[model samples]
Target: MRSRRGVIEVNTAQIREVADGVPDVCIYELLYNENIEVIEDQCLSKRKCDSAILASDGTVGIFVKPDLPEEYRQFLLWHEYGHFKLHYDENMHFNFYLSRFSWKTEREANTFAALNLLKGEDIYDQNVIALLISKGVPERIAVKTYESLI
Candidate 1:
């Protein structure tokens, strides 16, 4: 289930362009009435989980700790966007509010996040940790995500 440690190989640049092209509001803001709306309705919060929500209308809500580095926040938001695009089935209205590990859905979202953030890089590579660090990823998460890869 693991690939050799190498640079992340997804086309992050294109993903980033797609992410950047999104409207300049916190996608969450567009989905919920308040930041706490996600926490209350979805039971997912930036304070606890680096997670996001996908509304049925194709809107995505991303929760990020405000204190985290901006890059990390961007990655989380894009990850949520990935769910909106990849996991959301317009015909399935009840599937939008899912947990981080709700079957294969979250996996795809995570893949979207990892690939978008570290495209052209390998999570299995030796310098992977350093590269994530250079990109302003938190040291603990960088290490944890690295470990989770294997």
Candidate 2:
């Protein structure tokens, strides 16, 4: 993923390697090292909470709604990045926004984000739900991901 320069593309294998290799990955830094930019502007993606953008100029970015709570914003960024890494170069439009619905792509993106965010955490712990929630994952998503891991 980091092999490219001045271009927008997706390679999930490379992305997984990077994510897995890092202990305590910082999503922002993860995207930055991959040449993806993060933009916070509510107007850019009014139709959804966040969006993955592949610009005409070859710049790749995730656009997030600015007024969200910090924790939600964090997860939204990862969700958009999931869209970026997993769907962008496959068969997706140049601009894609996420809605709180259960479409296949949206579900896949959410699953992708959940897996990465919850990786290496002890899902068996009693505090797992609270832990993931405190870490910015929504309760429903946290519980779903936790159940899947179990």
Candidate 3:
């Protein structure tokens, strides 16, 4: 919410600040939660699975897979945090994961993630998707990553 630049984007620094108070963030180094999981392809390619979510208490459980550069991980975590902060308030009755179908909540959560992470501002002119590409972020995550910022 509060950023030094005064522009609100979905950058990792802002994300960390946003999630400063929330608890139980599980960032696995290699393994995934199966249900809620993040993965990083450890071979020749530095590809990472990005993130996952689980329903926990009044909050949504978040998981960030390993293998991303610190900056990218920050984005992924914020995305999950977006799910927690935005989606949790309105749609508590529905369980997102078990539905076996994508819902509007997920899209809203992603939008929150993008707005925070991408924080459209002049300083960071390029969108998150472009930034990720410039930084060599894996293609698999480009879509969601793009959605989050742009």
Candidate that scores best on TM-score: 2
lDDT of 1 by residue, 1-150 (tens): 211432112333444455444445543554454332333333443245666564545444455544556776666665666766554555554443343335445444554555456765555646876776676556765666555454
TM-score for each predicted model, relative to the true structure: 0.48, 0.66, 0.45
Which whole-number lDDT from 0 to 100 does residue 81 have in model 3?
A: 56
Relative to the true structure, candidate 3 reaches a TM of: 0.45
Ranking by lDDT: 2, 1, 3
- Cα deviation at 38, candidate 2, in Å, is 0.8
Better of 1 and 2 by lDDT: 2
Estimate the overall C-alpha local distance difference test score of candidate 2.
0.62
Scored by lDDT, the top model is 2
Better of 2 and 3 by TM-score: 2
- In the range 104-127, model 3's lDDT, one tens digit per residue, is 445544544444443433435545
The whole-model C-alpha lDDT of candidate 1 against the native structure comes to 0.52
- Ranked by lDDT, the better of candidates 2 and 3 is 2
Backbone clash numbers for all candidates listed: 9, 0, 10
